[model samples]
Target chain A: MTDTENTPKQTALYDKHLEAGGKMVDFAGWEMPIHYGSQLEEHHQVRTDAGMFDVSHMVVVDFTGEDVKSFLRHLIANDVAKLKEPGKALYSCMLNEDGCVIDDLIVYYLSDIHYRMVINAATRDKDLAWITKQVENFSVDIAERDDLAMIAVQGPNARAKALGLLDAETAEKVDALKPFYAYPMGETFYARTGYTGEDGFEIMVPNEEAAELWDALKAAGIEPIGLGARDTLRLEAGMNLYGTDMDETTSPLISGLGWTVAWQPEDRDFIGRTALAKEKAAEKTQKFVGLVLEGRGVLRGHQKVITDNGSEGEITSGTFSPTLKKAVAMARVPVDIGDTCTVEIRGKQLKANVVKPMFVRNGKSLLEA
Target chain B: MSNIPDDLKYTKSHEWVRDNGNGTVTVGITDHAQELLGDIVFVELPEIDTEYGADDATGVLESVKAASDMYAPLTGEVTEVNEALDDAPETVNTDPYGEGWIFTMKLDSMEDLGELLTPEAYTEEAEA
Candidate 1:
């Protein structure tokens, strides 16, 4: 039986996840929890209260030794020079030479000659290989830290409760940490960042300490979240998910990630800059837009979108938003598309309104286009 | 453990067919089916008066995980659909057997009922 099917990988907290009534599913080859019970409840829990997620499957890589800044400056679409302080984190999409997204990651400036990057779980092998190959003669050393585990505590009251599990000083430090910042207190790395569009922290702890922290969080009333809620929460927040929303063949410009590209300091060239410039000069036809289904049926990934002008597009990520109480999606449509379009679900066409990609932030609706 | 009612007939594809004792039969997903799909978000029912064959996909049930086909258990024409599911898909997850009935079909023939699996046989196949 084992030979007939490929077994999914388990993370450090796999047993804890199963113990909490988590329904396991194969996600990108990892045996991850889809939900403990209701996905909608978990989604609401994160928005209204506090919840924790075992996101340990994502890979963490560190760069050390001389000229690391220069190496990163040329590697990612966003400028590493933007990171000025220790533990400052910046989100960027690493692109290939043809201007397609290789992977979207957060790079943390640990110090002058050292930095850390966290990438998606599914793209680990290729992301590492790409970074390794590009570091040929640079004086930097690459270290993939598989020894650490990542846990995200998110929601309105998540930070205050997460502090209850840590030391007082650490709690104070966490309280002071600004959004989009990362700090190391003892062996734990706490970053005030999350994909859920809520006030929260993504904490990285040693593998041995992960389960204990999770148990403590659970004991303190922080709910254990699964990947099922994670997808809906991120979709409601209008965050882009890798592999689904954008892939190696899709450019960041058309994937709702054009804002992440830093075009200033025109002389500082990065990979795919020329291709992106050429695409920009030619006026890229496709653009990213948020779609809210105005009629029946669920709008799902790959559903055909028809603009008012008869142009065609496709939904990259779509879900039923629990907060907005409607079906919403992120789609790549023609630049000429108006504020509303039609989506073909099953055999019928349903009207949808096109808006900005972000639909919610900080537990409130950011519906303004 | 998933519930398998002894009185209802089941399809290998996870739908349940109940004999209404009249000329028609009521169709819905089983308890086991709803658990697998998780929190359902949308249900697209077949049009009234639409016809379908045994095991034909006539509608869709969508959850956060994916969209699955709601197959017709036997050859029949749809007489009524679960209109409540248009706004409340969670009925399928909360009450898969009762309120979540997908559609009712007027049978083409009493002979088509024999194609369905017995509850005992269905449990074995589903478990296996």
Candidate 2:
């Protein structure tokens, strides 16, 4: 048996990847496709054209109860009451008692009693355990949907291609779906969401229909992208990977995710509000920033960042951006550090310019330097 | 994939050793190694005149994905290093067997070549 079979999981499109000659790699305990052929070409395709990714490995958890909204308001760091529209989605981080992030997720409000969440695959077990343990007091039902498969179609022409593959009724409903919005068709759920920083739709379908939908999308000229391109694309777009950028041990303020935290409604109580409020009041010591290597060499994860004062931080995630043609990295450094720093690459310190991330968005350069 | 010339010997770690007509050998990473690494971004070659054993780590290859240490295929004294890699590191991924050569060395002894695998044997080992 293959490694994927030995595990307790397999994505619906696993066989399709094998047929396309995908190079498989072990990612977060799941066997996943790294690339089909040239990872560089795959990266370019998503930046220029349309591409589809089988993100079924990510766990989808559903919640249903009369007190669902109240439960979420306390369980998440962000205020979910802001999602007034039925199909609107809210991006929030589930934090521990100490204000450290457990996992960042998107909560889709379907109705007063129904909601859905998408969590990272690597932290599936931890996230499920945490949620299950906390739901004991609430009259809520939590179900892990292993029977569903998620396919993300992304790029400049992603919406058009995805619309072509969907049924007429479903396509019409999704045609005007705004960003961060989702609606359910007969059996498939379509969300106007993506990680590549492009206009796209993420479709959640039954396991039996996933392969057919994937084949239809491919026939419609949507290229199949693997995890290799996914990483570079997200990095270029300034999106954070859960484990690499932050984890249960790191606070959102220091990991460049403070924007997702909602501190409004002062009377409202959330899981990590007290700790976060204290940290914010005291003026934290750490901050997140982007770094671009001014000289030669690729900046990668775990590389040390040196300031004029001394070594002040380390790279969280780094990659040679295909769109920018230069190495870009996200690093956590002391809040007092300046714009210029040096990255220790292979024992030699190379000068780097610190800047706000989002280097590329919508096929354009967002960085000035 | 290009044919691994019969004249050269290989190690399971993917290093190729070409026995120069003289008592020297040219060492470079194989094509399979470069392909797996995607794009070579940086390479750290050993200092010239350094003596290394057949199993010693003599160099390092940093690709866009990960970093790997290149081992000395045979005992030798490093005679020349590929300085061109300083600006054109992608040569290791484009032409790993030719201009991408890491370093040349004067062999300590030619008998150690017997321990290396033939092209066919090396290919099988890599596929495994």
Candidate topping lDDT: 1
Name the best candidate (by DockQ).
Answer: 1
TM-score of each: 0.97, 0.92
Q: Fraction of native contacts in model 2?
A: 0.35
- The model with the greatest TM-score is 1
lDDT of 1 at A158: 96
lDDT, residue A187, candidate 2: 73
What is the C-alpha DockQ of each candidate? 0.79, 0.46
Q: Which pairs, if any, clash in model 1?
A: none
Off by over 4 Å in 2: A1-8, B1-3, B20-24, B44-58, B75-91, B106-115
Give per-residue lDDT, candidate 1, residue B17. Answer: 92
Lowest summed lDDT across 10 adjacent residues in model 2 chain A is found at: A1-10
